[model samples]
Target: MAGSSHYIMPRAEFDDAPKLLIVISPYYKDIADNLLAGAKAEIEAAGGTHEVIEVPGALEIPTAIGIAERMSNFDGYVALGCVIRGETTHYETVCNDSSRAIQLLGLQGLCIGNGILTVETQKQAEVRADVNDQNKGGGAAAAALHLIALARKWSVARKGVGFTNDILMAGKTDGSSTA
Candidate 1:
């Protein structure tokens, strides 16, 4: 079944002060390569350093992310994978399980980006894998950065900073303000 898209949050400006780890599944080598390239470009544009790790398939992405979180070196993570549906129930299992795992990671404040493409066919996967355009990898990197930014803001707010005028001014200067 095609998933609903209305749940996507509006994009937010990302803070560039944190290191990132990107884990990609190499099952579909070409698509994974494009995703890696897209993620690298976006991270560089945001002035952040990123390290890439490759796993065997989408099933291994969440475990890799969990391990990275425990290491405590990265401020965020981006997961890239391509799981094209075939003529078997295996497609549903992979898609659902991977999506749920990523959501669980985010709920636990892991700052994980989901760039996994669950498509019905190889052609659709290719269409979504365009590194320079319609790249889910770019979207995933943006999501990870957005989560990190929000987490940092929440921490500062909890410290009695109170989201003051000075903080607002700083955000404006850095183009972090929405309006």
Candidate 2:
């Protein structure tokens, strides 16, 4: 696996410049900076604009994105952070919970690129965060951009996924019951 290569998808396209929010946990300053750089470069390459918000730790990244999704106009989000394994179970908790929250947000229709790195050592984090190397941050950004493109491609004007007001009031409006 050392000399293996993988397929990389081309940058995503947008009808209008998509706005993205980059939520980063700068606990590991150097790693976080590298991740941010990669994410920003990828977003700009895709003709998208971005705003960055810094949180205290990896666990907070998802919360910040959730808040932005509800109160802002961002089309997507990039989550950046490094969680190097430590002696305590805190590492596992942080990794699992943060990832779960991000996935939940994505399931709720928020386009999110999860770049939080959970590694055994700082060296691993560095390699993955490096813009010239693995560039996991860039990969995350690409994922979000792809989702955004898909959402836009299938976007339609509709009431939602359930019963409409018309259906709910059908018989009530005339004070009658079908049965």
Q: Model 2 lDDT vs. the true structure?
A: 0.93
Model 1 CA deviation exceeding 4 Å by range? 1-16, 160-179
Clash count, one per candidate: 0, 0
Model 1 worst lDDT window (10 residues): 4-13
TM-score of 1: 0.80
Q: Provide TM-scores for the models.
A: 0.80, 0.87
lDDT of 1 by residue, 2-97 (tens): 663545555555544678999999899998888888887777777778999999889889989999999768989999999998899999999999
The pairs that clash in candidate 1 are none
**Total clashes for model 1:** 0
Model 2, TM vs. native: 0.87
